[model samples]
Target: MNVLRAAIEVARFLEEQEVRYFMIGGLALQHWGEPRLTRDVDVTVLVDPEDLESFVDRVLERFSPRIADTKPFALRHRVLLIATDQGVPVDISLGIPGYEEEAFARAVWVKFPAGEKLRLVSPEDLIIHKCVAGRPRDAEDVESILIRQRLRVDLDTIRQWLEAFRPIIDTHDPLAFFEQALTRARRSLETGGDL
Candidate 1:
């Protein structure tokens, strides 16, 4: 199966097991920003800490881990690196209780190109995510999302969430990154140029 189809299949499996998840990373960028070539499907699943072990076992039954001792690694890092039978990568982030909780609560169902509905992180939540990541590419993604979403995207909402995440995510200044990206996006839009 192709990447998109494989991603849809993954989503279907998650839904069948009644797991709460929201598409993120590139797949989500396709919906809110410029479409980019992404090799893997990224998703964040909100599983309680108590059930994490069983949850890890559940997914392992379907997808092959890209690395050895994936369960241990995932338990340590809260990220599961696994792949489908077709060799398509699937990154499942074991979400924690803060921003992730809010992100999942805001997840919205959107129909995929194949006519299957998949829940995805909202544009505002995704913007917060990109900002927190604070990579050059992630900044580009934030700008693209802003440009594409325009006024429809809520800047204040982004700011509010970033402020809430600031105390926890101290590596990069998410609010600063967002402001810079937002400024650049507005400038690019005003100049009639694509970011």
Candidate 2:
């Protein structure tokens, strides 16, 4: 479905609309860690709930919403699922009130293998996202990123954010969970084992 091209097109559209956004999820993981097959493009758009409908309308001009009531769904869940004409899925996360603005501020531009430049979440921020998701596969992705990034990633920042999200997400002991996951990743990397 030409996911890369679709990503480039979506990025360009967001840029044209002057939306502060960044690529995340699978596309981002490829940048920070091991490359893997990712069928969809995930992005975070920094916009308020009030303005979400306008954003959705603009996006719908090009991408088809996967759900019938995309606007209300996005306002409720803070995510909009859509697909390109070619059927490549795009998951757009409506910027959460506090956390997303900071993530957008911390985003840096990265050039993709196909020569398209996209703003992306920092490795530390990406780690926090993976931790908060808390799926086994998500943890595995975090481990891969941890091993590849090593000390270059800012652990303290990631931990602080995770701590801040703990109460909000109802996660118990986020730091401990992160440490445990990181330890497992370290062991795997050290043993030259697959994640």
Candidate 3:
């Protein structure tokens, strides 16, 4: 499906539209963790609910909505599911106010193997994303990222964001979740275990 090309296309389109967005999910994990096959692309767009229809309309020019009623579905779920011309699935997550907006602002430009550069969320922010999702796979991704970028990643920033998101997202203890993941990753690295 040429996922890299698809990602470049989506990034270019969003940049042209002056949308503040960043790549996340599998693609972001690929950047920070061990590379894995990812079928879909995930992007977080800093779009307001009021402007959703216009935004969806613009995206429709190059991508087809996965559902019949894209606007309503997006509004309800805060995610617009669409597919590229080559049938590559893309999930456009509507950015929430605080955490997401901060993540987008912290996104850094990354040059892919294809020599196409696109914005990607910071490693700290990506960890927060995975921790929040809290699935087994997500935790594994977090562990991989930690093992790979151990010295460089900012644990404080990740902790800060997780702490902020705790009350906002109604998470009981984000820091605990992060600590557990970090501990596991550290143990894996110490024992020479493959992540």
| Candidate that would win on lDDT | 1
Q: What lDDT score goes with residue 43 in model 2? A: 92
**Which model, 1 or 3, shows the larger lDDT?**
1
C-alpha TM-scores of all predictions? 0.94, 0.91, 0.91
lDDT of 1 at 152: 72
lDDT, candidate 2, at 67? 85
Clashing pairs in 2: none
Question: Mind giving the per-residue lDDT tens digits that candidate 3 earns over 1-195?
Answer: 988777877889899999999999878889888678988889999987688779988888768889898878987888989988788889999887877877877899999888889899888988998887777787778888998886368888998878876876664466778898899988988888664
- In model 1, how large is the Cα lDDT of residue 37? 90
Q: CA lDDT of each candidate?
A: 0.89, 0.84, 0.84
Candidate 2 lDDT: 0.84
Tens digits of per-residue lDDT, candidate 1, 89-164, equal 9999999997788778888999876788888999999998889899999998999999998747877889998988
**RMSD list, candidates in order:** 1.5, 2.0, 1.9
**Residue 169 miss distance in model 2 (angstroms):** 2.3
**Ten consecutive residues with minimal summed lDDT in candidate 3?**
167-176
| Candidate 1, residue 145: lDDT | 93
Cα miss at 59, model 2 (Å)?
1.2
